[model samples]
Every structure is written in C-alpha cells, then in structure tokens.
Target: MTDSTRPTALVTGSAGFIGMHVCERLLADGYRVVGIDSMSDYYDVALKEARHARLARSNGFTAEVGRIEEPERLMRLFEANTPDLVVHLAAQAGVRYSIENPRSYVEANLQGTFELLEAARAHPPEHMLLASTSSAYGASTEMPYRETMKADTQMSFYAATKKATEAMAHSYAHLYGLPISMFRFFTVYGPWGRPDMALFKFTRAILTGEPIDIYNHGEMSRDFTYIDDLVEGIRRLADAVPERPEGGVVPEGDSLSPVAPFRVVNIGNGAPVPLMEFVRAVEAATGREAEKRYLDMQPGDVPATWADTSLLNALTGYAPTTPVEEGVGRFVDWYRGYYAV
Candidate 1:
C-alpha cells in the first residue's frame, strides 16, 4: 500500500481524548494513521505521553502501545495495518472506575470488545466504529436520548461493560457480516480531557483552590459532547454503515439492530447541561471559586443525560452541537496551558 503511502485508518484509542481527536481527523483527512494505544495508568500517563508525542510527529502517524485485551495484540494490529477503517476507541473508561475495578470492566469492556470483534472478525473492515455510552441508557427515565433507545437497565459496572460491548457488537455484526457503527457518546468534554471526567475533575478542583466533588447533590445532567463536537461527530460517523434492520419490529425511540450490520447513533449535545451549569462552566473557566463537595450519588451514578441526535442526523449528515460556554472555554485554556498552573 504505497502510492506514496496514504490509505490507512486503524485508530484504536490513539492515546485517547476521543482518540486524539480521531487521530487528528484522520491526519487532516489524508488518512495514513495506525494508532492503537495502551498507555493506561487510567489517567495522565503524562497526558498519555503528550498525545503520543504529538502523533509521533506524523510521518503519516504510526503508533502501537498495545492491549485491546491482547487478542495477540489485536491480532498483531489486524495483521499490521490491513485496515480499511476500524476505530474501536480502546475501552476501560470510568464510571466510578467500574464500581472499583470490576476486573477493569471485565478486562477492558468485555474482553476488549471481544478482541475488537475478533479483529473485525478476521479483517473485514470497511467501516467499523464502536465507542458507545450515554451510560447505555441504564435506568432510563428517558428525555431526549434516542438511537432506538431500550437499552435494558444497565445502571453500571461501567454501564454493564458498555452494555456488554453493545451485546458483543451485535453478535459480531450479526454473525460476521460486519459493518458496525455503535457510537453513543454523550458527556464527552474537551481539550485533552479525562482525568476522570467531570469537566476534568471540576477544572482541577476549581484551579486548585481544592474541594469540588459535588455529585448527586449537584444533581446530574450531561449530554455535554464537545471535543471538537465529538471529533466532528466521529468524522461524520466514519461513513454511516449499518444496514440489517429490515424488520424485527423494534421501534419507538429505537436502538436499531433487528439482526445487525449494527447501528446505534446518538453523538449528543442534543442538550442536557445542568450539573450546576456544568460547574458554571468550570467556575467561569477558571476565574475560580469551586470548593463544593456535595456527594452521595455514587454507586454507578445516573441523574440525567440527553441526546437524540436524530439518528446522528439521519446517519451523519452531521450534528453534535457543542457550546458548553465555548466548550468550557476550551477546557479552561487547555488547563492553564497544560498544568503550568
């Protein structure tokens, strides 16, 4: 594959903040990227090694720090980049660290999404994106949240290992036809984020004056979705591929998969903000003043989340609508210029 090398796209979690903005928008859309990551001290492994040292200085970006539950290192990274398209977004994300390490969410969200759906069921990747959330609508008192919503009650062991890796990627996209697309992200924040979420821990405890915890007393509500509008609605949903629904009769705010080529959209910002106006946009983006400390909503939390991105704008014509006070003032100016404090 070398007509001056530019046809790859394997991004598993490229030192992740939405997989480093979806491998910097697939290297600004020219593609050549292989990224796969495992720098998981769970957080700030030196900001995931400075976002894999700025995408390994982009000689068409190549990276590989293992662990997709090691199906021989994701089948040796799908036999060394035979990738046409596969963006699994490496798992084990948090929800109170899956109620205190429930086997690190059953070995990274159910055996690492069943070893990236068995390396896209032995290399059949033309379009396979799978990062799901909105806490898989557990305990649903639904208001907004759609993508065929009926995600049985998954209150948490990290949303039941992301709803058991969306029912093991809809039985490997209905027994290996494989064209999956399970996105469901919601409270995605911004600017190299994730030191355990809540707007990067309430903007690093409201710029270090320290206290912030809040929780249920702040009374949740999220659907935030920003990281450049969730990597531009996941690069327009890596091209909307999910067909198999021609009747199994499952409608009413849908969760699509009558039998799979799999589908589940909702990239959210379909409005839901209040957690005290998202800590008043990180206390007005770091002018400071948090010290909150409320608590008591633990044990797999859930107070609210909203997203009905109309089947991700009817399958990616586009829609993630960011604006949490300009995405919390671009994560408070990249957390005061990357922790210079």
Candidate 2:
C-alpha cells in the first residue's frame, strides 16, 4: 500500500537506463513510484534486471513486469495506482535495431504509446512527460535544434515513431485537456547506459584491445547529455506543466501548443562534441587507446545533432551543460567497475 500523503508516479520502462535513474530521483524526492517494464531482449536483460533490483530496494518504488502495449494491464495499473504523474519512457530504442526490426518499433513505440494515451485519457494525470529524441529533428541541418522548429523530416523509423508519439500525445492533450510535455533528448550517455550505445561499445572494445567502429570517419558530432543532468532536467520539467496559451500567442522561443496544454522541450548538453574527441575522452578514462575502424556513415544516421535549450531554460530555470570529458570519465569508471576490466 502506498502512503496517501505522497504523490504517486507511474513510470513505464522502469528497468531501462533512464527509467531506473528517474525512478531513483522520484523516490528520493518522496514520491511513490510505480515502475513497469517488459524486460525485452533488445539489449542485456541482465542489465535491466539489475536496474530493477536497485529500485526494488526502495520502499516507495513498486516494480511491475509488463509491456505498455498491453492496454488492459496498463489500465489496471492506472486504476490501482491512480498516479498523479505519468512518465512514458518504454519504447523499442536504437536506430539500427529499428531498421533490422521495424515491426518492434511499430508495436512498442506506436502501439504501446497508443495504449498509454488511452489509459491516461481514462485516468488523467496532472502532468504527463513523454520521451522523444533528437533524431526527430532528422535531415534538418539546422544547428542547435529548437523545439518550435518543424520536425517532420525524420530519417529513421525510430525517429518517425517518436515523432508520431508526439503527435498522438498532442491530440490527446487537445481533446482531453491533459497537460503534456515531450522531452527531446540528445545523445544521452553515462553509467548504466544501454549496451547498444556508442559509449558502452567503445569502452568495451578499447578495454578488450579490439577495433571500435567510427562511423562517418570520425566526422560526426553529438550533443552528449549526461544521464544525471538529463534526469535533473526531467525532474524540474515535471513541475513545469504547460498550459494552452491564451490568444494563441506562445511566448517567443517556446513550443507550447496554442490549442492545448502541450509542449516539447529539448534536454541536452547544448555542446556538440566531435566523435574523435569523445573517443579520446574514453581513452583518457580507460587509459587505453581504441583501435579505430573508420566506416562510411550508416543509413538513417545524421552527421550531427545540437539542441537549442532556450525553452528548457526559460521553463525550468536550468539546462544540461555537462562537459563530455567528465561525463565520459564517469561512464568509463562505471564500465570498469561493473565489468571488472
């Protein structure tokens, strides 16, 4: 039984990397957290289990194993928990994986999000924050992407599904008066990150004296936001519920919907670091140079991504600005300790 005094939050993908961190933060902040994850085999199930185990240590956190696409299950959870805040983070992530298995994205990102929206509509929360991606700004060569900019040109199926969720959530918000915020994340990485991410892969390859793949021949760049910073940004944004602007007049640089209580905010470091520099940071942390295997840019891959966090700053009075070197060093330390390398 949850304490009636504290507010409850239903977080999907609770066992996932970001989900685990967010659950910890919420529990620390005195919220009762109901976390759900399907434990999909996309990456390391063991890692997901480890994250779940950590969260289970908290009395305020309840872990449930289920897919978000299961509408009946989600509805039951909503009815039982009656969460004041809902955070939707469960999705089939990874760009290359989406290309290999597009159906997974369709099922998890599209169908799963649809189910979540239905549940939220039935049991409306005070605020609902969904995770979008920087990839939604696909093919837009604009540096420092702003949330107000048009984001229709998604280059990957992963990005397309995320963009679709934003639209789906907006419709629900407009029709049902649900307060919603979509966070567009830029290259999130740190300890306990996905095994599929570059930081993990590069660290492992370097430690094992193997060649690490360098796409775009080290020409690419990313606004690598640290996990803690990203979680902190989300924590603040959860309180900054958007309201439909009166007179259809959104503030300059804001992405608030004029017709609904909806907005998209970019959570990023706001500093795009080159791929090689990131590799060098890994080397500095691990004390081992990576054997580089340069390769052509993969399909659905963009050359760079930089976030314009002005709207985030205006809303939360803070922005993610962790330097790559320090962020990468922390990841390397965790990798070494976790893997005993």
Clashing pairs in 1: 147-254, 148-253, 148-254, 148-255, 149-254
Q: Weakest 10 consecutive residues, lDDT, candidate 1? A: 247-256
Model 2 RMSD in Å is 1.1
- In order, candidate lDDTs are 0.81, 0.93
Can you write out model 1's per-residue Cα lDDT over 143-239, one digit (the tens) per residue? Answer: 8867665778888778778878878888888998898888878878888888888788888877778898887898788878888888888788787
Stretch of 10 with least lDDT, candidate 2: 63-72
| Model 1, C-alpha of 80: deviation from truth (Å) | 2.6
lDDT tens readout by residue for model 2, 113-230? 9999889988999999999999999999988898988999999999999999999999999999999999999999999999999999999999999999999999999999999999
Off by over 4 Å in 1: 1-9, 12-16, 21-49, 54-85, 88-122, 125-127, 130-145, 149-176, 184-187, 191-222, 225-253, 267-271, 274-279, 288-305, 308-334, 337-341
Clashes of each: 5, 0
